[model samples]
Target: MIEIYTDGASSGNPGPGGYGVVLKAGKHYKELSGGFRKTTNNRMELLAVIKGLEALKTPSHVTIWSDSKYVVDAVEKKWVFGWVKKEFKGKKNKDLWIEFLKLYKIHQIKFVWIKGHNNHPENERCDQLAVAASKDKANIGIDHFYESEQAKETLF
Candidate 1:
């Protein structure tokens, strides 16, 4: 079984954002993180899980540990499936959710919600990685979909 711990942070709701992930399988371990110039905490939260899952090279039993209810509850409570039937109308993060479902089908996945900033070792490490990524200026990347969507919103 593979275990993944993830966390996300943003300076503001739609400001600089980042996600952190720690993946462990037996004795092998890996850490992943990325930053976006403009995004949301929830986006980063979901993206952290996506990124972690994407890193897996094969289908396996995976358990995801997350601090965000937005990510955990949506899956655990089966709300995302309902959203899919509606074609994600009136929903945010459609792009990410679609990507997640693609991965969701390929692996046997489970989610465990944890309290954030509670001194859990892996969770704290993920939080540190996320915060550092969000503050890193040189490697920051653009979240194209989010930025374009924001632009369209401003035009209306």
Candidate 2:
């Protein structure tokens, strides 16, 4: 079985954000992370799970550890598929949710929630990666919701 640990961070509530994923299969471990110039912490959190599943080579059993209720509850409690059926109205993280549904069908996946900042080694490492990537000067990714929300804020 493969194990994946994930975290997401944002410098400000709606500022630059990033996602981190640590994947382990057998004895090998791989780390993956990237940042968007602007986004919300929730989007990045879901994206971390999506990217981790997408990284797998074949349909297999996998367990995901996340410091996010947004991601874990949606899956563990089966809300994600219902939201998709409703076309994602009134729900957050639609982009990552759509991506996640694509991979969800192919793999036997399970999600476990870990308390963030509670000294869980893998989760803490992921948080470090996410924070570091969000602060890097070269981040090029864009978050549509981030821009949209910023536009709304400018009107106030």
Error of 2 at 15 (Å): 0.7
Q: Estimate each model's TM-score.
A: 0.99, 0.91
Clashing pairs in 1: none
Candidate 2: TM-score?
A: 0.91
Q: lDDT (CA) for every model shown?
A: 0.97, 0.89
In the order shown, what is each candidate's alpha-carbon RMSD? 0.5, 2.0
lDDT of 1 by residue, 27-130 (tens): 99999999999999999999999999999999989999999999999999999999999999999999999999999999999999999999999999999999
Worst 10 residues of 2 by lDDT: 137-146
What residue pairs clash in candidate 2, if any at all?
none
